[model samples]
Target: MPKVTCHNICDAIAAAPLPDGMHTKLIGIDGCGGSGKSTLARQLAQDIGARVIPTDDFAAWDCPLEWHDRFMAQVIGPFQANQPARYQRYDWHSRTLANWITVPAGGTVIIEGVSAIRQLFRPALAYKIYVETPRAIRLARGLARDGADAWPMWQGWMAEEDAYVAAELPAKQADLVIDGTQPLAAR
Candidate 1:
């Protein structure tokens, strides 16, 4: 229920006892747009020498939240079997699927994005992390990163995130709720 203080998330995860099911432990990093999920994922990946697969890789212009089934089948399925997980990466520039990515069996695999911690993927996750940042800060981060033209998209995403969160209390279910303003600094 409380937020993660000044601590290395990767350290916490690496030390936590993991349950057996998947050869690779999954960690979901989820939050609203510009809430620092990607930053946390990158830092955690580097900290524990793990790999990350963003839901953006599966984005197809349809509701981004609608990725649980496909992601579970394509990625989680293989990982659970101790085999490499494969996914077709979506290209935002071209608006098409560009290439297939192979994620080998490993210690930890991070899933990062708005709806990364969908209910379907929970059974395979070692832990779930939800980044919480204020709307003002998130909006500022979005404008700075995606430029002024992205406000419309960000607004729509925020609304979607709100509805999703309302329907599913992800934060309450999270193993660790992080303050996005605080970076997941590597030690």
Candidate 2:
């Protein structure tokens, strides 16, 4: 998808009525790899006093989809139960499990990553945001971030993401679509 320079994205978010503090709300931030989905999710969480749970922490370097069960068990289940939940973080460099992180209560949680808004988790999300960026730009960003050593892997990941999104229809299901290449307005 081509990146749109619409400043209205955050404006729309701001205009929406804030959810009551009584319930936990999950915000799924979905996009192609290195498309600024994480950045936007973090900023939005900070702006709205929400906590961010990055899906990158769950995905393995070689097998990103393998952590779905862990994600559901640790994060989603606890949040749905209205309790604090802890999840083991993936060590991307070591390609192993790392430290465990806890998800706290009382605020919206931003789940940010490529498959963060997958069909299995859609019902659990209070709102979904799709970050639309150009494929060329996304590929450039991914390669730059991951380095030349992982270029082929990155390409494969991109193809996998394309196939997943096509089958899942996350963009069509999204409550909001943001052009992540644009700068967010200063609060």
Clashes of each: 0, 0
What TM-score fits each model? 0.90, 0.86
Candidate 2, 119: how far from true, in Å?
Answer: 1.3
Off by over 4 Å in 1: 1-8, 60-62, 185-187
Displacement of residue 78 (Cα, Å) in model 2 is: 0.9
Compose the digit string of candidate 2's lDDT tens values, residues 86-166.
Answer: 998888888888998987864678899988989888777877889889998898888888888988788778878888888
Candidate 2 Cα errors over 4 Å, as ranges = 1-22
What clash pairs does model 2 have?
none
Supply the global lDDT for candidate 2.
0.78
lDDT per model, in order?
0.81, 0.78
Residue pairs that clash (backbone atoms under 3 angstroms), model 1? none
